[model samples]
Target: MNHKYIAFETIVIKEIRRFARIWLQTLVPPAMMIGLYFVIFGNLVGRRIGEMGGYQYMEFIVPGLIMMSVIQNSYSNVVSSFFSHKFQHSIEELLVSPVPNYVILCGFVAGGMARGLGVGIIVTLMSLFFVDLAIQNLAITIAVVLLTSIVFSLAGFINALFANSFDDISIVPTFVLTPLIYLGGVFYSVELLPPFWKFVSGLNPIFYMVNTFRYGILGTSDVDIVWAFLILLLFITLLYICCIVLLRRGTGLRS
Candidate 1:
């Protein structure tokens, strides 16, 4: 038991250090890019647009943007880190060791969560410069962000398990994740969407995440909070199970 805990701790620390060592590449860039979004979208265009969802446009978008940072960083950190291990064949050593698959998975996910939540805190602080934020529901706010990060972190692990090359890792983020985020009610409310598009947005998993986070901040949401949480939990369960199964099967680890 102690050995498994030690292994888990070691892997988590290694993953954290790997990104911390490259702070310029991993951390600085996301903060800078999100800062740019605040400047362009929140400050400049937001003035002309005025209010959205009964709040100032800048305020309305802040939660979504923060959630966005968390999602992207969490997903990218795990996918890239795990894939690198696979690429260098170090993952095989870990797999062959006495470490349990669940420990390995949890370690990587925790590291990803660290990066994701770290960037989230940075971005939240940055958002303070653009608009005032008061937590409407502290528990809900924290819960959604944590769960959302875990979901993406697990997702990134799964992506890495199946990834054949560097190119394969980027494919899901570019073509799939980004599109979902934009359409997920980040910049605008689903209420503004026409009937058909509103129904379509309901199908997007990210839609629930963004809205739930928004609700946490603003005390308002387009979707029911209970249902949104259920969806997030569902994703986490499915992804975690999938990752464990893949690890046992040595999906991409076996050459």
Candidate 2:
């Protein structure tokens, strides 16, 4: 095999195996959390919350929960995995090798997508245990899910590049990612929000993601579904360009 191909294959495979080797950390906990959310929020609190957009609260929020797992896991996978390589100084080995930066970037992003999509699938299956799902549009469902994964994976790559310490790896997820996901129409419809907050929430990227997927699943949405796909594609391309530039410049790669 060509050296670049070998490196790409090795790096991607290593990333995949890393998660597989620790299924407990990578997979089980998220699935269990999904189950808990269904029980606590969907069954209990959701009953009091009543119907949203014509569906039960549990059904209403399933798309958001799935999108949330997809976003968090995808982003976390690349940030932690790539940053670990940097921390161990192994990135230097690849940087000095013949592998193109693009290959390296794709390999890690591929790994992140794998973890993200894996979690989404697991969450979706778990959601079935709570209520029957109605997938209104298959194409929209897959497109939005894939786009959400790609965007967040790139976000994770950028964060990993900027991260200097273990704590640095978490700042984006803690401060930025969490708030965005929560306020992204997970529990309440934006229609019920104050006019000012409604306009502000419109700017939330996750809102489009969850809304588009919700439209696909339940045939109900707050935003134009086409706009959601366009927004996600725009972010994906922009983020990919940024990650490529950072890899070429070796930003934060050296001590």
TM-score of each: 0.98, 0.96
lDDT of 2 by residue, 95-153 (tens): 88788988989889889999999999999999999989989999999989988998999
The per-prediction tally of clashing pairs is 0, 0
Backbone-clash count (model 2): 0
Residue pairs clashing in model 2 are none
Candidate 1, poorest ten consecutive residues by summed lDDT: 246-255
lDDT of candidate 1 at residue 227, scale 0 to 100: 97
Q: lDDT of candidate 1?
A: 0.95
In candidate 1, how many Å is residue 143 off? 0.4
lDDT per residue (tens digit) for residues 1-255 in model 1: 599899999999999999999999899999999999999999999999999999999999999999999999999999999999989989877988999999999999999999999999999999999888998999999999999999999999999989989999999999999999999999999999999999999999999999999999999999999999999999999999999998888788875
TM-score of 1: 0.98
**Local distance difference test values of all predictions, in order:** 0.95, 0.92
Q: Cα lDDT for residue 82, model 1?
A: 97
